[model samples]
Target: MAAQGDNRPIGVFDSGIGGLTVARSIATSLPHESIYYVGDTKRCPYGVRSESEVRSFVLQAGRWLAAHDIKIMIIACNTATAAGLKIAQQMLPVPVIGVIAPGARAAINSTRTRKVGVLATPLTVRTGAYTRAIRDLDAGVSVYGCPAPSFVEIVENELATGAHLQERWLQDGDVFDTPENREEVARTLGPILEPGIGIDTVVLGCTHFPLLVNPIRHALGEGVRVVSSAEETTRELTDILVRREQLAEDDVVPEHRFATTSDNIAEFAAAGSFIFGQPLKSIEHISLDELDRY
Candidate 1:
């Protein structure tokens, strides 16, 4: 007789809906596993917040998810991961996975020049998590950490305005395709694109960065390779599940549930649907005080 598979849902949390990119990748990679995602949108843009604040926020979200009986948890925000991953792992009941290490490993594998550029939130860059992770993996690699403090706001603004609702926006191009947006992205990305940097691989350190990939790619030019930790993180999740025999059974149907700390649940659903590549059937508005009870 074969060992039974665990059917509990995987928990994923981020500062905002940006983490949907990681949740989407997990759903695609592990179709049989269910997912419970929490987005703390009420106090988003964790990149600009203090390290202690980000850590506190990460724990509140993690504890809430853990109380819901999730099998595992993934800290989908790069800033949160940088600030709170170790403590979350120690405090949470389930296994905790962070995006930075996987992203660093992926960047290392993709870089041919051994010079990798990391575009992330201000706090993430300040923490030097990606730089540390990359160098720890391979001391020969040169890591450049660039702060893109405006990128998250750009993504959140688009999501708030229902830009994601337009089929053309989703299928054809995003807000970054506009001349104004293009200029903004280019200017913000100037440091990494400098001739002296000569990086062949660029890591999207924040989950939100993936939504702006088209514009980012345009700015970086054709020679640079863009990498997102979403896929690599999902791969790590799969390996852990397989080792623990916790992979959802083939016969089990997968269900996805979403929650947000924002008052505007509708906006979250709309943006989440766009990022998740499917209409979100279940979405609930959660409160910070409620999460504290967990």
Candidate 2:
């Protein structure tokens, strides 16, 4: 165990369960570290919100997490990261990491061709964070970022089983797994992947986008590589912890805590189980009104 950060839980937050992708990666990569996750499912889809509003929500969540004595803060939402990361670094006492830089690095490393395509939320696309990050790594890389506003809604709706684990997997098919869903996704992506783009790599720039990876891969074809921020972000988090001597040394299985700013916490718990691939036995409910106090 590192002398300084051996016992504190790491904090992670997203607008909703989509960030579970990152959470799953962290659990797999750094099994010894504990995690406290906050999902603001009630006021979610922060992608459509104004930058100032997104920043405020992120800070509210960060404050709540920090109050619990977390060792570090991970903003797992791409929209929130785009809107609030720099401010979060200044505001929070612990290290604050976001999804864009790691995803950008993954894309930059995976692309054999210099062209990379980004599919993300409207706000994230507007921020151009991924483009800037990729360019920062290698100035000559071509980035084509497209706003896929409906993807988040699709994922949320698909994850909505209304508290029943058995019902979560739709009979027709999971959100993007059906032929109809795949066609719709392909139609949505057509303009983004138009002829002559020649992008050899595509970054799933929004955390929610990973849920639709199958359809996205089908739409973009097998030739292009699809990169999600989860894996690389976990890698970055692990590297930071190790470099700072913050890695937990004990063999004890880490305890995970889940919280949500949602009225229907049962649904959120179901969604967590559905998206996170973990049996979420319980979840604490938090209200936006409470977050407003921070």
Candidate 3:
């Protein structure tokens, strides 16, 4: 029989399709491991929800993932991580990994000037998770947090409409490379990229924010290092698996499954394929109404 630990899949979840970024990274980094991904698309934009509400939603989803016999769980959304990780670590049977600490660690390691900036949803900013994580590593470093809620909408199929974007930023087009587009993005993000902030590294605090890295990096200028938790978090996952001797032993193709709390599984699958550059297998629809029983 196969090693017991290696046979179990890794459970990863986000408020919506954004966590696919994390899933994609995990697949790329560990080709032999199976993944069970859950995206709470029906009640997405978890950024606006109260912490208690988000925590409840997260727990419901966690219980659902646990039923699949996953060996490890990754909380891929910053808002969910802020609201639910502690509770998850306390209650879940498997090791719970979150995006904030990895992202903060990557930023602190990449910064040349001890100055770091974080762009996240307003809810994440309110939690101060990134700020606290960074300071926990190095108390002398300066951390700045900016709420970039619009970026989340832009990534999850909401088109950014403005004369400059002309529906391109939300469309499948590159807007970050062109000078005019960059200028427009800079102008649009002016308030967030405030003056006199000499940060050398920026943490993309929300999982969805990675989709807007180009524009965000351009808006912040060339000098700032843009950091996404996907890669760093994947590295953390790899280390954990190795330390636990849970790494899969073969390169055989692993079964990956997708689940969403949304009624529109077709739309969610389309968006997931677009984000991951691969056709998603049959997506299972999960209902929050039914999940409330657990």
Candidate 4:
């Protein structure tokens, strides 16, 4: 722990359980720290909601993190981050970070052809967060946005993969990241990606897109580097904590605190264990009836 201040836990939140991807990355990148994660699974898809709704939801959930004495607050959903981060930063005292800036920075630094294709949630694409983040680096970088709604849905419902999990949830391929459907999605998305842009890299700006990495790589063809916001976002969080002198001194057998506002927590935990590459240390359910309390 830093000598100057309290080494309270870090808090991570998302519209749904997909933020576990970010949390999982954080576990590896900052093993010494304790983390509290909240999944707003009740309103799982914030992508189509109005900005006001997203902001309010983030405020409610992020405030819960604050109550937990979190030293840092990470908005793990790209859509929520796009709509809520600016306002959340103003309202919160801690160092607030989001996946967009880090992911964008990574793409800008990695792209050889200056043409970057971004795969994110519908709302993130609608808001042009990735485009703005990339353009902030250099206006000439041809940044394209592709909305992968099904990817988020698959994750929200926890239908990722595995024999037991597959039996638990109905197995039907979606609009993206499916073996049968990926090529078609690519064909449709590829046209929007102008060849003149010389796109040689694609940014998986949405955390859920990380699960789609292999399929996306196959669809985008060879040589296109697929960068997930997961690793880059984790690196950013680590740097921010270190810069702020908030990193824990030693690994505390790193505990994962999972809280969800949905009835499907069992499914999420199963999915998260796979993503975290470890079993959950704890799981708490936020009963829908307790909405007003939270």
Can you rank all candidates by TM-score, best first?
A: 1, 2, 3, 4
Segments of candidate 1 deviating more than 4 angstroms: 1-4, 168-172
**Estimated TM-score per prediction?**
0.96, 0.94, 0.89, 0.88
Can you write out model 1's per-residue Cα lDDT over 46-151, one digit (the tens) per residue? 9999999988888888888888889999999999999999999998889999999999999988999999999999999999999999999999999888899899
C-alpha lDDT of all candidate models, in order: 0.90, 0.87, 0.82, 0.77
Better of 2 and 4 by lDDT: 2
Q: Stretches of candidate 2 above 4 Å error?
A: 1-5, 162-175
User: Could you say which candidate leads in TM-score?
Assistant: 1
Give the clash count for each candidate.
Answer: 0, 1, 0, 1
Best by lDDT: 1
User: Could you give candidate 4's per-residue lDDT for residues 1-294 as a string of tens digits?
Assistant: 444243577899888767888888888877778888888878878887888889888888877788778998999999999999999999976778999998898899889888888887788988999999999998989888887766666555444343255334345533235555566456646654666666888888677767666567777777778886778888888777767777776635556688988776667777777666777769999775664554
Which scores better on lDDT, 1 or 4?
A: 1
Q: Model 4 reaches what TM-score against the true structure?
A: 0.88
Residues 1-294, candidate 3, lDDT per residue (tens digit)?
324347689999899988989999999889899889999888989998899998998888888788778999999999999999999888877889999999988998999989888888889999998989999999999988877766676666532222334345457576434565456557655764676767888888888877677777778888888999999999999988888889876766788999988787767776687666577886898887877976
Model 4 residue 254 lDDT? 57
